[model samples]
Target: MESMLIEKSVQGDVESFEKLIVKYNRYVYNIAFRMMGNEEDAKDMSQETLIKAFKAIGQFKMESNFSTWLYRITINVCKDELRKRKETVLSYDAPLNEDEVTLKDTLKDETYNPLLIYEKLELRSSIENALNQLSEDSKSVVILKDIMGYSYEEIGAILEIPIGTVRSRLNRSRTTLKNILQIQLSEN
Candidate 1:
């Protein structure tokens, strides 16, 4: 189905392209949100990414998956946006709004203890804070690998670097994150 949509969109079918956009819209927006850390900026970047992808569809070789190419475009768009607003960091907070119930609430009958759940959530928030301290390059590599679960080769293609470079970046980023995590742990 995705292949057919890509083919039809490439063949100038507007509806097909629109369908593809709708299908991947949330996925794109999530990546942008992780990179930008704001809903408005994420929406703007996501729109820009789709527009750029549509404009460049003719050049897409299909040597890799369409989603991979689209993800690469999304990452590039986020990088460009990050460049203009370098070194900005978001203050990490527990997602404790009414719409977002605590992990304890979600774990109703689970075997996991409530204290453990709270601790894990706090740890996750701390990791996110440490991530905010990283350089954009390191943050991008970490998010693409650890959060989004992209393989090293895919990351290389997306970042337009060699797989070895991606591996090294991931290693360095993880090391930095681990050190930060340790500091946070000791301080707590």
Candidate 2:
């Protein structure tokens, strides 16, 4: 069913392309969210990604799965958006200085228990914090390889870099993340 839709869409069937967009919208949105962080920006990025994908459908190589190619395009669109957003530092990095510290101490909510703390640290939030601390190139490699489950070769193809560069970036991102986590823990 999807392959048929892809074929039709690639052939310039607007309805088929619209259906394909409907089918993959959530997947693309989630990827955008992971890459962008903010909901508004993710929505804009996802919309722009779909528009770009539709525009370039004729040029898509059928040698790869449609979703794979779409995902690559989505990531590229996301990278462009990130670049436009300028340099955003990880919120975790700028440790709460005196005013923030006082506010945190005074307005502490009792909602976050150890279990909740562990759960938050287990997935998206913690990983995002770590990734946000990385250089954009390193962040892109790690997000593609680790979060999005792209293989090194696929990432290389998507980024137009060698697999060795992808692997090296992943290693450096991992090391940076480990160091950041260690620092956070020791400070706590």
Top TM-score prediction, candidate number:
1
- Candidate 1 lDDT by residue in tens digits, 25-94: 8878888877777789989999999988887887888678777788889988988878887655422222
Model 1 residue 127 lDDT? Answer: 81
lDDT of 2 by residue, 77-183 (tens): 98887788777643323443322222224336634332244455554465676666665666667777787788888888877788888887788677766555544
RMSD of 1: 8.8
Off by over 4 Å in 1: 1-3, 88-118, 183-188
lDDT of 2 at 93: 37
List the pairs of residues colliding in candidate 1.
none
User: Which portions of model 2 miss their true places by more than 4 Å?
Assistant: 1-3, 10-12, 89-124
